[model samples]
Target chain A: MTDVPPPASESQEIWRRRRGRNRALILVLAALAALFFAISIVKLAQHPDLFTISLDGPNPSAVQKAPAKP
Target chain B: MNTSFAETTVAGGGEQSPPSHSVAFANETELADWIALLKPRVMSLVVFTGLIGVLVAPGAINPVLAFTAVLCIAVGAGACGAINMWYDRDIDALMRRTRNRPIPAGRMPPGPALGFGITLAAASVLLMFIATNAVAAGVLALSIGFYVFVYTMWLKRRTPQNIVIGGAAGAFPAVIGWAAVTGSVAPLPLVLFAIVFFWTPAHFWSLALYANSDYAAAGVPMLPVVAGAKETRRQIMLYALILVPVSLVPWAMGFSGPVYGAAAAVLGAGFLVSTWRVLRDRQDAAGSSLTNDAPARAAFRYSIAYLFILFAALAVDRLVG
Candidate 1:
């Protein structure tokens, strides 16, 4: 395949990937991130309501899913 | 030089026309170039794995933050890929696989690309911090540092396993995405991380199977170049063997449904079969299925699909059930 030109800026992808290093990091940073300012924008997008995970239902009973391909 | 693929292509009459001068007049980068910049293909896989981490984790964040977090992760991934392209533009111009990239193709200057990458990196990290937390932001900073410094600057020029060690940069988004929602790391996320981490060797070496010519032409020390096809195939198969079970960790841990487990099983086995083809056959004389009959290309393509599908299933299980 021929090489494609890069239209987007490079640094942004790096910034996005780096945030995953730690778990506590996500929470502490998010609470402080002031992304709430972006709440208006976030609310406008798809699947905005984040459910607090609490499992209290019947067992999933291990239903082997198929492998993923994109 | 390991000119096998390119050599064979030429032998098989895969005619080489000179670089099309017409492209100069065309001026504007085609759609593929911009797609290359967003690193959309990479973004798809990285985003999928990150989604897995986000979904399988036990806690949750505000939906807004979560979306913002995933968005940041995708942006950050694209940013890193762009900078990598920018930094490697010189060598990129030499290899067949990358010779047509915007920077290398002379569609854009390296300086502007570098500027663009740096700006995106800074913006994404800042956004991560502002939208999420310091930890995630810091991780963002460090991920860029590692990719730019460790992988791009240090390891790539220095070793063949550059892709192996450097693979860490690609795997971080999942944890970042998970943390964005849950606000903390846990066993499940680590398991997810491990799956991607281990899968890297098997996934990349197959591409190297066919791309070794470009690598050799560029003097890059890819595994197929350094170790030869036989050894590389062995390594691919070995990694695939290990990755299959590792890929199943989420299902084994009860985080996903049986559907996910089934998918992982089938795909993992398919990965093994493809790698095994590379390992068992030597039809390219030294090369195998990956290099010759174009199965390696298929494996390379499937590997991308495999990672995406695997992670997507995890997200579906979490969200749907």
Candidate 2:
């Protein structure tokens, strides 16, 4: 079946609503991102050791020196 | 119900049938319609009480996390409202007060509204868990489930005691807020829950008394519609009487200071007077108001203000005491 185009007034109304919906979605996403960021900062502050990562390997001296290889 | 939104085009004017699965219909809804689905007015009360719960709880929470907890409560409450609107669209269409909701008015399809609600509900619970504790998140999820399942789907249409039982869903925010900080429920938060629980029937029945016709038209068995206006008025008074003492429980239990006790007493007295006026409003033997249900309307308005002020007093007392 062939498609029929909507009338001008109806098309304009549809565009208006679509634009509004798009804007609202953008605002909501931005707000959620900001909220998540704030929550992360607060949680990290409350428990600084929550994500502790030791950059240094185990003390080489503390480990017995392996004999020069086999 | 089976109409595909993608297949349907918008006609010039009038309400359209809801689409089954798509949202590409001509009457793409505006942002305001989506906001309307959230029921922001109801969210305001939930947020206020939840905030008070946080403030009055006996512990310290980071301000950011506290705000997040309240935000989650508000969003969760709004999610329930959106789902309720979706489920009740049929009855909403019949009721004068709700005929203009987005789904019933045909500005938006039901699919998107339901999706929006479920998405928000899940997100709120997840966010609450992330920002607060497991207990807070669990209570938040329970509140959403109680509202969507127990109240909206089950009890709303089946019984006149719907408000009485369903009010527990609304009472959860205070407990949720307390849990967010303390990570557990306390006697104080439970008392606050009781206060809101008892306060709800009087608050809603006052509105139902005046809007009896709308409920009757919609075939929703609100108390006034099922039990007659006279019985509803007496029930309203009974709840009001119970609510006054319940509201004072925090002070009586030594959880609050004298400021709260005094405010609760004064507010409870005012509430009783308001309900008493409603009980004695000019009505025939059948309890239908001859004077346009003005006293019920007044009582309805007073109930909202009463809760706001009473909670504010509690918060203030906690802070100052």
Instruction: Give the winner by lDDT.
Output: 2
Q: Write the residue-wise lDDT of candidate 2 on B113-144 in tens digits.
A: 99999999999999999999999999999999
DockQ of each: 0.08, 0.37
Q: What TM-score, to 2 decimal places, does chain A of model 1 have?
A: 0.19
Candidate 2 lDDT for residue A37: 92
Backbone clash total, candidate 2: 0
Q: What TM-score would every model get versus the actual structure?
A: 0.73, 0.91
**What fraction of the genuine interface contacts, i.e. the true contacts, does candidate 1 reproduce?**
0.18
Q: Looking at candidate 2, what is the lDDT of residue B43?
A: 97
Q: lDDT values of the candidates? A: 0.71, 0.88
lDDT of 1 at B8: 24
Off by over 4 Å in 1: A1-37, A40-70, B1-35, B284-293
Query: Ten consecutive residues with minimal summed lDDT in candidate 2 chain B?
Result: B1-10
What interface RMSD does candidate 1 have?
A: 12.9
lDDT of 2: 0.88
**Quick one: best DockQ, which candidate?**
2
* Residue-by-residue lDDT tens digits, candidate 1, B107-132: 55455567768877898888778777
